[model samples]
Target: MSPLIALRAFDDSINSNSSVDGVSVVKIIEYVVIGIVVLSLLALGYMGWRHRYNLKLLGEAIAHRKEKHALAHGRRTKDVQ
Candidate 1:
């Protein structure tokens, strides 16, 4: 659902007053499952982003090390004499 629709639904849920005040077992379980699913998705996304960043950093580090090693060995050019 779009953000607007979700926001409207949330607003409605919050504004409406139910006839019964007590919470149902089914509702509790549903809420728990929804929360868990949302959290799991968030965690998965974060991990994926972190992994990408780490890979990029590793690539950069490797490239830097290669450049430094080349300077140290005085073999910067790839062309053979």
Candidate 2:
């Protein structure tokens, strides 16, 4: 909403007898909080997925390096201890 509209709503709420605008304000805050929570959960899930993918790559790299080292030392691939 525009700043002018928001200011008008606030002004109307203050002048009104009932708590009608207050209910809208509370609903807006509730929606904002729910949105934040959902976004944070998605971000954390993505981070976790990335971390696992990186770990798998690191493991493969380490295995490749060890195999290369063993081959350089004249050891068979399966015989390397």
Candidate 3:
């Protein structure tokens, strides 16, 4: 809605016609549904982004452990312990 329309709607008297009141209940329901869908998508994107960071950290940890293990045990001719 335009700024002028918003101001007009708010300035209208109590006895005057309510632009919002004329709006259909279904339209309100549709808005609610759209809001829910948008929120859900945002949540999904956030989760994916967070998990990517977590996976990167996990990979670094694994590499660090492998390096530590190699350092603790000198390289042998055979891969066996």
lDDT against the true structure, each candidate: 0.73, 0.75, 0.70
lDDT of 1 at 52: 100
lDDT of 1 by residue, 1-81 (tens): 964456556655763443246654445555677799899999999999999999999999998899789989987735558
Cα lDDT of model 2 by residue, 1-81, tens digit:
965466557756663543465555444555677799899999999999999999999999999998889889987577536
**lDDT per residue (tens digit) for residues 1-81 in model 3:** 964455445555334443477874444555787799899999999999999999999999998788778768974333555
> What's the TM for model 1?
0.67
Error of 3 at 37 (Å): 0.5
Q: Candidate 3, after superposition: displacement of residue 46 in Å?
A: 0.6
TM-score of each: 0.67, 0.67, 0.63
Query: How does candidate 2 fare on TM-score?
Result: 0.67
**Clash numbers, per candidate:** 0, 0, 0
Candidate 2 local Cα displacement, residue 38, angstroms: 0.3
For model 1, give the 10-residue run with minimal summed lDDT. 17-26
Between 1 and 3, whose lDDT is larger? 1
